[model samples]
Target chain A: MLIDVTDAGDPRLVDYVGLRDAQLRRPEVSRFIAEGVKIIERAFAAGCTPRSLLLQPRWLPGLRELIDAWPDVPVYLASEALIEHVSGFHVHRGALGSFDRPQETGWDELLGGRRLIVCEDTVDHANLGAIIRVAAGLGWDGVLVSPGSADPLYRRAVKASMGSSLALPWRRMASDSDLQRLRDAGFTLVASTLAPGAVDLAGLEPPAKAALLLGTEGQGLSDAWSAAADRHVTIPMAAGVDSLNVATAAAILAYALRP
Target chain B: MLIDVTDAGDPRLVDYVGLRDAQLRRPEVSRFIAEGVKIIERAFAAGCTPRSLLLQPRWLPGLRELIDAWPDVPVYLASEALIEHVSGFHVHRGALGSFDRPQETGWDELLGGRRLIVCEDTVDHANLGAIIRVAAGLGWDGVLVSPGSADPLYRRAVKASMGSSLALPWRRMASDSDLQRLRDAGFTLVASTLAPGAVDLAGLEPPAKAALLLGTEGQGLSDAWSAAADRHVTIPMAAGVDSLNVATAAAILAYALRP
Candidate 1:
């Protein structure tokens, strides 16, 4: 059902209000907002149930099939100007869909995979999203994030991943002890660091099942996580440069250690 | 010279005004602004002459030696709030330096080395910066960009490269004939693309002197460039995923084709 919304403050459009405000975007609300027609399509293709959708009529034709399939979902049509006023920013792509956030994949299923990306405290949504996109693009099995990491389902993360975050398998660890669980399942834990004594990445012989541990942008793999890994690998960099961006580093490691 | 300026509109601080506004930042003026202490230090370390400096009083102690060395260069001190007001954004690291932009390296000097990254119309400063950082960290010799590419000296690009854009040897091509120059220099032109029939990146052997061509974010390598390349290499991606981010792709290619 298409509901035409003329008022920007309509209660039904609450999910999208002030979306640019970081404080107002709560991932715990059990719903994730996918922006643009492509990402919304990916969310639907991934079998996510739409809670509702808010978009200009111009986008309705493009998403008609997806909307038609979910007859019970409310599709709110609004003017582009109203969307900008409500979201506090221009909705350049002209569409947004609120979908039920997918549940975290079970650890047992995640650990059973051959290749994985384990991010520790990667708080930047763009970096986290790019990591997911890289992992999925390179055919990696899944992603595991520490509790402190950014929500992969956050609007910015989902958009940065070009919707790959919707299609990729990802989960947050209940606790750091999850590292031990990965090891217990016979997965090799490889820590990516710039510290000395780390084996050159070019020389690494990745095992059948490997978990690459990447850390934050500022403070790389924490001392505890670096010390606990089965191996430490460093991409040999030139003199005077400190390190690569966390996401770029992840991409290199993902491709090099691909199964 | 330490000059205390309480006014945000002081003409001496013109270089630091409206930094958040792209139209006001003119690289044609032969001056580029470096934000933060670390980047400013990189600019000095790279032997870039200081036109002037602006920062809060708290950061003075750290940069005392550098300031002392450049006795004639004026250092404008201001409160953090005034600095933010003038820059039109928070000077998060509390310092900004206006430095003389260095001249582009000659093609012969850049191509004398074995490896290079060639970017075409990469308008995004962050992507260009990341590519530079990846090139430097991976020990690539230099970078070449089409005339249409973003200025590597742009504040945002310099910061994104972790200041590597300042350290790396990069030059803009005068025209498409630069490709012919690389070819004449015995540099193998390898175009990175997602097009079918491109050789699998893993199986290809990089030439002794190779130049990897990267294109804009939305479009892959242009038809002319792709056709002119000596070889086309692609990172095999999983189905359903369109492509990796340009910077992420650059990192992977740089690592894989490392000399």
Candidate 2:
């Protein structure tokens, strides 16, 4: 199963190149490329099967058991130099794998009897991944991403999440219909904003079923989202400072309201 | 006085060269380099004076007003090619500044009505900076770094903070003695941990005068520090996930407990 490959143009590796946004429209096309041993192992531990793997010849010994564990998957081998050439960057981790992205869950299914984070237009992949990592660590049940958000399956996101993005229950809001569906599911929308009229984050009593809504970097939550929310809360900051990173803000808000 | 220098090792730019730990520790090191225009401007706005400004000649027209405002600071000129070489990297931002690091603040004075974030062993500059940025935005009073923490004045920390590190009140705690002094004061020490019998993060109400303590990346709270704390709280996480980034965790905890 460990076949050696030298050509970057190999038809099998087509799914690996610039694979970030290819499946934005069709979430089914989402393929996760987990690099490094720890991430790959975690992905498998999370019940994800590697569709294929690319490894440096030197790592063959270390990866033998893992490869043996996945006998059905095509384990491609190449020289370290060839891997560096094909990857177009120095991959010190010595290995990479392609895995099918996990399936999505409905808002009610994901949010039932648990805390949830709603990230609105968080377009940065690293921030998205970091938020997921925090959510996983802070006991949040799941994450709901707006359509304008970045693909969470990006290599940077997966690596940044430390592989938790794969394991965490998350789904993209397919459309405004999806957002409306979430609103109708009895989840109290807590939109985070810094406007004068907003209540202090700590001042609010915890809701029974809640979604902590975060926003983009510069522009905060959209008026429509704020209008739809049951409450608007602000993390009181110094007079001159702007806002915290959306992920950091979400982590704090989610933790504050954790069920 | 604009001087154009072609050499990377020009003595006039000594403060801006190969920025390592030793260089940052020098007592005579008055000026820290700011990479982007926003950070440089923020430093100036916070009443920190710039010793000199460096920029690609192409930026001359756009930054005329800002340059004119800083009448006392010497501006150095370089071509796009020369600027990149001198900085040892690409200068896409087209501007940089050398500003004086401010004097330290007394712990008591910094603690006055300020929601202080006390970082124990967070030695990562990027995380330190991000935490500062969040602290500033969330209306925290100041930040205190323990013995093993990274220098906030480091170049990367300054960049990551988006310049808010310069604006926020900050100081370093050289040892356990300094932490003891903080306890001698009436500051509540809320150390974050994953240990059994710890209070849940959400349940622990914010104290009027409090300092939120964060630990290192892999290791949770140290036994000595955890014992010293007035209260120990854990951010409830899912069973399988490892942990959150130290800074993200800090941000969340800080915001949740902010006054």
Candidate 3:
């Protein structure tokens, strides 16, 4: 059944308005509204099930089968004007889909026989998304998002990740105890930092299990976190340049430690 | 000498007009216009002498000494209205500077006994700028802008690079001869590609004299360039994820090859 929404205030479209904040609330109820067909299709292909799909009447004929593929999923068909109103912005390409928010992956499940990528205080949505995209590209096993990190499921992050957030396993951890749990699970926590005694990234031998930890772009990892790391490594940079963007740095670090 | 012309089309401000087209025609002219005090300072520190420092009347008192610090450099004062007109956009921060264009560095001189990062066809200004930022941070020797590559000096690219392009040595090459010369000089040409026999990035050895080659965002690399690489290496991404952004890939490669 294709429902139609005519107003921006439509109750059914509430989830899609001013979506930036909703994603940060709780991953379970925080739905990721993928607006374009490509992103939605990619997310779906990566095994994400859609909650409901909204399409411009013009696109319904071509997207009908994909919507039917999720037989129980509600499909909403609306006019272009209605979509623009409901979205609070022009619905440029004329389609949208809301996916049931997947629960955050378990730390144990994520650490199970895999290389881990940990982000601490990386709050920028685009950077977080880029990190996820690279994580998926470089074959890292999972991403562990610290409490201070942005939600990987944010619309911008999802789009920036090219929908790889759907494919990459991600979990959120709130404190030292959360990080310690991974350490207890036998994963070597390698902190990417510029501290004294840090080894050149290439010099370190690939560990059987390792979690590449990165910090905020402005202020790197907290002193406590760096002190807790099993190893600290730095990418040798030119004298005058500050540092790579957080996401770029994470990708490089992840690629270097891939088992 | 502060020249204040409030109108958008003031004659003295002609050089700074139509930045977008100027960028397309000759993006390397970036030494002429850069945003923010820090970037302007970096460019000056890197030996890019200013022709004239343009400023809104309000920021004049604070910037006078810095302008005076460059004794020979002219400090051009203008009204906020004039600055907006000349810049082709509102002077969001209320100041901008026009500096004398720096001489293009010789490729050999730029690469003299140091690591070189190469891009074949990376077209995104942000990605190119981010790569330059990474290059600066990672202690790479220089960057080689091959045919079809984005202009490093484009406004967005420069900003994204965080002005590292000023300190980093770069040169644009219009002919295949430049690449051939690099090859003959024993620079190991490593192309980031998905070609068969492309070693996993982690498995590769850091070369003494190497060029980390990259392609555009959507398309990976051209056959003509890919075949020229001494070796092809891949980041070994997870299944179903697209390629990493070029700048991110460059950072990873540069970090992997850090000396």
Instruction: Report the number of the highest-DockQ candidate.
Output: 1
- CA error at residue B37 for candidate 1, angstroms: 1.5
Would you list the clashing residue pairs of candidate 3? A137-B237, A237-B137, A238-B139, B2-B77
Q: For residues A34-120, could you state the per-residue lDDT of candidate 3 as single tens digits?
A: 868888888788777788877887877777678778787878778877777666667668788888777777755797856888889
User: Which candidate's lDDT is highest?
Assistant: 1
Task: Mark the regions of model 3 whose C-alpha exceeds 4 Å error after superposition.
Answer: A1-15, A18-29, A54-65, A71-95, A111-114, B1-32, B51-65, B71-95, B110-114, B205-208
All-Cα superposition RMSD per candidate = 1.6, 3.8, 4.0
Error at A167, model 1, angstroms? 1.5
Q: TM-score for every candidate vs. truth?
A: 0.96, 0.85, 0.84
Per model, the share of native interface contacts recovered reads 0.92, 0.94, 0.98
Cα lDDT tens digits for candidate 1, B181-253 = 9999999999999999999999999899999999898798899899889999999989888899999999999
Model 3 lDDT on a 0 to 1 scale:
0.77
How would you encode candidate 2's per-residue C-alpha lDDT over A72-151 as one tens digit per residue? 89988877766666666666667888888777766657857457788888888889889888888767788888888876
Candidate 2 docking category?
A: medium
| Best by the TM-score measure | 1
Residue B182 of model 2, lDDT score: 65
TM-score of chain A of each: 0.97, 0.90, 0.90
Model 2 chain B lowest lDDT segment of ten = B19-28
Question: What's model 1's lDDT at B153?
Answer: 91
